[model samples]
Target chain A: MPSETPAAYDPSAYPPFAVTVDLVVLTIRAGALRVLLVRRATEPFAGRLALPGGFVQIDEDLLPAARRELAEETGVRLGRAHLEQLGTYGHPDRDPRMRVVSVAYLALVPDLAQPVAGTDAAEADLVPVAAVEPLDRLAFDHGRILADGLERARAKLTYTTLATTFCPPEFTVTELRAVYEAVWGTTVDPRNFHRKVLASDGFVEPTGETTTRGGGRPAQLHRQGSAEQLHPPLTR
Target chain B: MPSETPAAYDPSAYPPFAVTVDLVVLTIRAGALRVLLVRRATEPFAGRLALPGGFVQIDEDLLPAARRELAEETGVRLGRAHLEQLGTYGHPDRDPRMRVVSVAYLALVPDLAQPVAGTDAAEADLVPVAAVEPLDRLAFDHGRILADGLERARAKLTYTTLATTFCPPEFTVTELRAVYEAVWGTTVDPRNFHRKVLASDGFVEPTGETTTRGGGRPAQLHRQGSAEQLHPPLTR
Candidate 1:
């Protein structure tokens, strides 16, 4: 039996479980929300698409582990992405090989070059969120993890300045609005969205420059502000 | 070196880590937000107040492990509480003995009898949120976990209808307001609060009953509504 005394709690007496970190790296590409996926190269589910992830190292912290796994599999550096802990999944039977606990992370990155699979993944691709049949295509419990990450992203858009993470450092309000449109798959009235975005204290601030990217007229450029949360959350 | 091939991923090759579940159970007592804490009875930080927790069994799921730990440490049944996964803590130096990844959970329960300490804890007590010196008093990394749980609960009250979790099945608007007051640690104008609560769609609905709990005029009783979120959330 495992130790019953708190002071005498012996970790070695209990069965040890492997801890892994999984990344749900999301980006807005071609007017759609897409997630980074890797084709598994070996047997548990060979050739199957899965979220890029790997075992956490003994010397690293959770975030560092996530960053390492992401970089190793997808060749994406940590500095270019915004990552946060999504949740942990530890069902007794989540892994067939053994008891494995996964600390899932959610990441958002601006448009970048297509990912090149490195160490463990056979191939890396950005799959549209709408096209992912999580239950049918992904290996293990990745589908559930992906769904939770998407939900968290969607919810964060409502109350946090997270949407800005999907845009360039300097972007137009229209570009920012497009992010919500792509992720939510719904058109928001530009006038209303503009008013609401500006009204929410510290959501965004003018950068004093105008940009005319693929546009007929120059639009005011804005940057993310210091606020972490929106007072009157922009609910969907 | 660890396997670089995805198909060749082996769990046994890498070092295994022990997993545990910790609970940051919160409730309101005497109009103060309180958290359930146990005095460690053994050598690692013995005699310190820490969040009630224990090792996760091999066959049990994360939630079940948390439920079992809560019951064993405090005799609080799972059914009377609203529990959710908070986050996972796994810094390499977090535990002095070995790598122990803890899946922390946050629970909210209605009024209940004082908890009786079990096998591991020397004593269990409800500590007011304001009094917790998380950085200095708690064992392991519990102070950080407790702080995170408290922040989550405080933020949840702003957007989610989580305050209802702190009230009885049937309660008055005043009682509901008290839940907010205790959690937020601020006074809200009663008239404004009443108007806002009634205006927020699906926040609460009358149960068509009233009670004179403290010998004053009976106030209409209300219950939680079906809405998971409060539109135009109650900001602190």
Candidate 2:
């Protein structure tokens, strides 16, 4: 058959461009806020600390790319977590060699699962948020991106049902309280927190069950409600 | 200079990558929100509609890059607007030719100045936010970026000292009400708004002045205060 209309230009016409997806995974662990990070094994700041990231394939949406990176690096499913597009970082100089643009995602996993480090990662670990002080040395411009994502996570917990994403399908109110306390970095009165949660419509509905996750009195188990947007949004 | 340590095969050996900052300039016009858009005059997607943007110069920060882009394309200082980093977007195929990445900023400017089209921009216009639906034809993944930016802007106004950024330095309470109405696309009780503004500490301070910009009873003038973060965030 005759060749179809000539393609404008072959893919080889331009310089080799690398696309990647980075994940700023955050969670509450042991009464402190933590972020998921990995040590780089390959060149380009090998051995330096960095966020979980990897190359994006040719056929996937940006979120899918992030989920793929997460799965590849940590052996986690794209589901069982709260994920959203944080933003993108594409500075020509961001990468030293060729041009690389990264689509970053902000992920909140309720209770972290054991990380199954990918072959590409030198080592993966959960880092306490407080320990990342001198973030200036973080790989890429991710230091800034991480900060933005963290702020968004903190603020979102106050107004949306997003915080619930950080917990299992059915969780105790006390567990939910911890998520708030960890994110806000402030101690909330348990009595007040309890009242507010029940007052906010569609925030949490009783699952007709109770949980003894802790050794104290069994707490009521609740699930996320139908409300998508929180009305009269919760504030500090 | 003298020969230093041979930094053996550093990945940093690659050429300095290029970074760009794109701005999604938004304003409320004609009772509906509008966004500033420019048509590219050169390939990749020449003559296609896209947000106004440009490469970030070596000496500039992200905010400055956004402002410079605005001034270069529209011939207006976007300094007074409420400018915030929306996030970064760097999908490899986002730019067909090279590995180009963009840092996107969301800017809200009070309807103060008219835009003058630029040389690179074949056509410039303010398109209503509702009219420009993200139907897979917005040049790149810019439609997704715009949606995220708009949501951030709308949510921010409810809890920060941001809505005032969309109003002149000396605006009336009623004028302030309009800013919220336009941004949130909802009606607010004027009396409730006035009372709430007075209640929020450092929200606004009386200038002992009044404005005569409109033909009506003199409206009181107030200046923005120095509240970095709102403790009890405002809710609609």
Candidate 3:
């Protein structure tokens, strides 16, 4: 504890730390929640699967840095993805090469084509959330990060209109309910869910279109409305 | 970007960053929500009000760093303060001296004795939230950080039992409603609020005691329950 005086201050005397951004890009495909992961090709955790990320550039903003790491490691563009800051991790020993503090981001995106491993990763692929554990383990505390991201997604889906991010621009009520079922790993009553969703004003608006993609009859398509937060959250 | 191989890797090549922790310690005092602030004793923003904070030590964890800075700058020992990480702010030019990434924390504490400025601050005091802006402003990006913390507190109050943190161990249902009023800066209907709180199970439980400190009939005391997230949130 030294006195706070300019004459005695030395900014360069502080310890140096490296900052990086890790992304937990999630999407639902075939009624399953999946996360985009990469096989690391570097030393500390060589050839092990991890959430795609890298060292942030000096002049880059935190959000852009996360998107850059996502694109560079997986070669998948982040177009129309719902990206947000999840949290930051600084366990001191989380990275072995040096003291690295990583800012983690959560992204909800529509299912796209399979990712190609970019220069940063040995291989890249979308792994099902349920199939990830008790089988192939992730590297460098990634399992914990992925868990947090999933919880955030599940919790936000209950109170916000973010579930539409997992669907296409136009989606049926059944398709949107499947997002909640996939993320929460539970089945929701179709009649009850449809009534609640239609009751929540500013949550969804009809597109004046019909889609018979899934069977039975042509269901009306809807899109996310202008509400940022739901008043009476849809309780599961 | 180079090949991801140990032989060609240089961890030292990454840009260096100095990490710090800034806290938004809030409390309800005199029917108003107040924040703990310090007058910087050093250059950059000397003699101006800023949230109490400091650089993180080389071996300290982020939460401990936040607690240490609170004690060091405002002489506030954070006993029983509800503390949590709010977010991380890292604009490239936020700190004129260097690139400093600050992890902001939110702490909801019961009102305590007047603060004595510690070694890091020239002066310290609790300022009303409504009185902060359009008058003396905070240093750096602290204004934005304060707004984020305030929003978090207001939002969490609607869905969580954290509003009790602003009160003593034993409190009447009426006193609890005052906490919501002070933080949200609005009037809450007393009868409706009491009915809602009592209806929400695991939100509050009767203490089998009564208090008559507010010049009314003996009011039954209640304490927070075991629930983390409310099912049917007590909406305002």
Candidate 4:
């Protein structure tokens, strides 16, 4: 309830603004990167698709609110997924009804089943990034939020072991490389990619198991290593 | 104003929370990296050194609010400084009075004159990072914000040309190295540092000027170049 003015500095002088949390939930599905979007059921872009989000509860922390909203909207528990603060959007005119500030969260979850519409959403679905041209058309500056989240995810793959977050517990090197390819939207040289990934110590560790799912030569499986960062980042 | 509960979905049902912006202003001064902090004059950790900051205006954007608070508290203009959204803090109990969420900003400015305490502050001064051992002692989660900002500044220097933000418009390689040393708190090999910085394309460009301020050897002046990212980042 802190006032906007500094001279008087009253805690309750300024009108309160609604604070909300938005989740940009992303996953790699069918060899493409997709994001979860919900259809707004109310006015103020009523029919437009928007990111899954809601107001933060008065008793909750920022991350907890984000987790609660994500779960309520998509029925996805954030157990092992990677979630981080993206940014806050507080343009006075962003929300039509009144002043509302939204703290966005970027979540990278392993491939999951399709999402279902929750309480506040009319519909929910996973939309491929390539299908959504001119992302600015989404509800209430959400296009900008989505773009920022995607950029953060793509950039994080270069230096962090976040790419592993998109894979199963034990995954082949090809599977890990596919994550980079899908997120970056480009083909990578398999040989060079393998060499570079392996050269970066603690990026991935062998599980001593091989996958012959395609009836070809068995590919060794690996799991995420302890190191969080790539010493020499795999630049795009 | 969005409601806190999804079941009712009333925009006006929930009370509004106060939103503020806190700034972590950093600069390289006197061969050390220091942050600008203000001693509070009001209750709730009064007399404790906290980052200079204030409430966001109803009509202003987040960045503008940060700039205004920073200038008012420290008498430093953000005209040439590098500013970016750091993160948002929204623990319901962060403020004892009410629910307050703070959007934090990180700013890197060139060395400047000493600061004068402005409104809402009893004292304003630049304290070296080494001096603030347990940064968490600052007023109301500011210490954690400062730690996060410092880690971000260090990590950014590895992959971005952000080191230039700490230097003046025209500076020598030695002066640039000093920035790295001060922020990272480690001495870098001059020869290797020079070679690496120069090899990184568009990192810095020669200004065809020389300065012998220290009276050792004339050092050529350089300016920040167009590239924003450093490929094969210089790791610690």
Report the first chain's TM-score for all candidates: 0.90, 0.88, 0.90, 0.90
**Model 4, A190: alpha-carbon shift in Å?**
2.8
In candidate 4, what are the lDDT values of residues A122-158, reduced to their tens digit? 6778889888757877999999999999989887887
Candidates in order, TM-scores: namely 0.92, 0.80, 0.92, 0.92
DockQ of each: 0.50, 0.15, 0.47, 0.45
Which parts of model 3 are misplaced by more than 4 Å?
Answer: A1-5, A8-11, A75-79, A134-137, B1-5, B8-11, B74-79, B205-207
lDDT by residue (A21-98, candidate 3, tens digit) is 888889998889999877776667777778877777788888888887766755556656788999888877777777
lDDT of 1 by residue, B64-129 (tens): 998887777667676557889999999998877788899999999876666556666377788888
Clash pairs for candidate 4:
A1-A11
Q: Per-residue lDDT for A177 in model 1?
A: 93
Which pairs clash (backbone N, Cα, C closer than 3 Å) in model 1? A7-B42, A7-B43, A42-B7
Each candidate: RMSD: 2.7, 5.9, 2.7, 2.9
lDDT score of model 1?
A: 0.81
True lDDT of residue A147, candidate 3: 90
Segments of candidate 4 deviating more than 4 angstroms: A1-11, A195-201, B1-11
lDDT of every model, 2 decimals: 0.81, 0.71, 0.79, 0.82
Judged by lDDT relative to the true structure, which candidate is superior, 1 or 2?
Answer: 1
